[model samples]
Target: MASEPGFLPRDGLDRLIEALRRDGREVIGPRVRDGAIVYAPIAAAADLPAGVRDAQSPGAYALHAVSPDERLFAWANGPQALKPLVFVPHELLWSSRNDGADGPQFTAAEPAARPTAVIGVRACDLAALALQDRHFLREPYPDPAYRARRDALFLVAVHCTHQADTCFCASTGDGPEAESGFDLALHEIDDGFIVAAGSDAGAAVLAGLDLAAADQARMDEARAGVEAAAAAQSRSLPSRDLRPTLLERLESPQWDAVAERCLSCGNCTAVCPTCFCNAEVNEATIDGRENGHYRQWDSCFTSGHSYLHGIVIRSETRARYRQWLTHKLAHWHDQYGRSGCVGCGRCISWCPVGIDLTAEVAALAGEGTA
Candidate 1:
């Protein structure tokens, strides 16, 4: 069911923060970190990256100062996504201890989950979160840890009124505006924010703010803001029906061509919002008195990802690149009923060599091969 929309004044931002914190939820939002906008725990409205914008391009990102009146979410996105909140980068599965007389004992090391409110979540990342829910929660053997975190998650999604050169969420059907799956969807406007609740909990939060009711004109401005961003995008995926084309082009020359420039550094997967590959390892002390089994993030681009008893199937960079692209664009739909790439363009912006996957796919599909 849909909840009513309201208008929150710029100063009223603190009221929302206090409301969530009062509910014992840790508020996470965007902030400047290491020269870029990254998500972190925020204590108050002042912690948000106000008047800060980002300039992004293939293999480059720079932060610039904007006037205070500029939108708070004037930047596109950062390397961090909603993935880390649900699927932790590193998780302890269990631990073994050597008892003095009892021989050995094993104990499960489950992660402690806190009720979390994530502010300033982008539309593209909202889609990624839903996709990950399908992979980790809806599956037959649902991930308990992911479920715990997901259940406690309260999404405060923001519409994209500003886009980077690399973003293509418009083409991917992910967003410039969110349709669902958020507790609250916000559209930042001059002097305030247009906010709508997606669930009862969000409505409860909104009720506490005592915000003014949103009129048609305010709603129109919010819609126009999101639409303007969609039209401004300069990059897009080649097609909506890209699966068959990508599946057939697995043996194309483009893979080898791109592989030559690829460093196999795993930057694409590392920054990808939808990529969820992981590897399990056992960490033990030097004396072997205690050992912990953990699952950590892994990438398909790595040479050892396909390693077997004595041989690696994808030893060559070309093969590994092909596997990664094919799995991401084509095979993922068969497994998850959706494309793995959300068109967030993190792969394009963060690639060390500026290798653009959309360009590669377009070339392989015989459209603008140049």
Candidate 2:
């Protein structure tokens, strides 16, 4: 049987944080910085972005003080998605040193266990993590490093009560609420939090905190509030079946139009939480006496991504752009059972040209031009 849901008053959040820390878990959460909310290592509960809202745009983000401190969690997503913590940006797979007599000696660092709790994770990012799990952890050949971090961490998902102009989670059916793949889910109910456990671990946390049980009426109200926020989304993708539609429109001349303005700077892939493609390089001393190999994040926009024998599959800017879009919206489903995008809009918000992906998909679906 499922455990009963619990509620935690907003004032008790500090106690909960301290308890998690006492239990030896490193707690990280959002904090107000220069002019935006960023995920940083937090100690005191006061460091969190309490009573502040963030305004986001492509290549821009700003922080604003709220009136009356109505909803402390009323904020849009952040510029950085929580991907690097799991899929390291760079790592050394193995290193070798010369033991003068022995030809070469190699040692590899085993993946270490991480006991971490990330609070204030947005709904879109939660969905992105689920998508990444399918690619890196649930695959036949799982990534040992990613699996270690994912298994040891606890997720605290937050419902987005506010939406940005670039947000489109509704169209993708991924967010405005914590649907799945979270241990604990929280809804901002005025100054307090309507907390619910999504898994056994979440229930254990709630039990440890000894929080009060949330009544059915409060749960209903919280659900309604989440639905209203989802309905208030200002952006949406077209309703066409993205996989078939995008594959059919691969040569429809729209690729060149988008590529013309796109700098091909690879910002989209970098900000994307589910892009797991990477490349490996081996380095050695000038005399080739010692050597080591390292893995680094790679993107489809790179010229060397498709290199084979002296030929590149996508040499032109337009071809590379088309390949990226098609793979994300079309081929990804065929390869992985789910779309590569999580509707986080991180790609759109980080793009230097303000290239909105929702608009691009709508244009490709023949709804209208971006």
Candidate 3:
């Protein structure tokens, strides 16, 4: 049976947090840290960045205070996403030590994931998480650590009432309002949130919250806010299926144009939620004592990424940038059943140089259809 929708008042949010924690789940939520909103451990709703909003554009982001406001998730987004929670940036796969008489002994890092509940997830991130699942949990060799962490996750999604200029999830058919993949979804309004459950666990949590049944007036208001946020976005991809057209434009001069300003800093791929490239590293002690093997997040923009047989394939910034764009917009469809971009616009806002992919797509896509 479908769970009835309820209005979770501002005070009820605290109770909801308490309920999740009481259920033996550690809560992770958005909070202000180091001049940006970041996902961090939280004990209560008070830990959230209440009344804090953000303004985002190409290569710029700023936080502003909305005084006398009770809104906790009034901001569009921060630098961080749900990627770090499941796909750890740096993880030790295993470590080895030298034994004097015996051979080398290796100790694998045990998957020590605990039940975790994340609040204030946006629709774009939910879509990105789905892609991450597709990449990590594929057949033939699923990532054990990623699978363990993913299994213990409980998602609490929130509709984006406030969107930044860099947002374009509507164009990608991803956001403003979350529809699926979340355990509990929140439709935020001025006074509170209109909440619904997408899973049995979510229904259990909702039932314990003691929230009132959502009324027609507030429900209408919540829908309106989400619609306004979607409509307010000015950026968009040329099409949802940019596979053929982007691939056809591989030799286009637009690559040179973008490379003129591109920094080759790998920030775009680093911030991208769907780009899952990792590099394995091994360290050995000079005294032949011990060795450790680690894996860390990597990016295509790195010059070493294309290293093979003592030769670099994508040596120039232009080629590397082109590879990123084509793979993200075109090649990913073949590999992952859809374009890799979720239109979160982290690449744009977090870019050291203001290189907007929407603008780049507009430049390259001249009268071409997917």
For candidate 3, what is the lDDT?
Answer: 0.91
Tens digit of per-residue lDDT, candidate 3, span 37-92: 99999988888998898999999988988874569998887988889999999998
Query: Largest lDDT belongs to which candidate?
Result: 3
Regions more than 4 Å wrong, model 2: 67-70, 283-289
Which is better, 1 or 3, measured by lDDT?
A: 3
TM-score: model 1 vs. ground truth: 0.97
TM-score of each: 0.97, 0.93, 0.97
Candidate 1: deviation at residue 236, Å?
Answer: 1.0
Candidate 1, residues 1-370, lDDT tens digits: the string is 4557899888888888888899999999999999988999999988888899888888988898887666788889999999999999999989999967997799987757999999999989999988898899875789888899999999999999999999999999998888889998899987788988999999888877877888888888888999999999988888766788988887888888988899999999999999998999999989988999999999988867898998998988898888888888888888888788888988888999998888888898888662
Ranking by TM-score: 1, 3, 2
Model 3: residue 36 alpha-carbon error in angstroms: 0.4
lDDT of each: 0.88, 0.81, 0.91
Backbone-clash count (model 3)? 0
Q: On a 0 to 100 scale, what is the lDDT of residue 170 in model 2?
A: 88
| Residue 277 displacement (Å), model 1 | 0.6
Cα-based lDDT at residue 19, candidate 2: 66
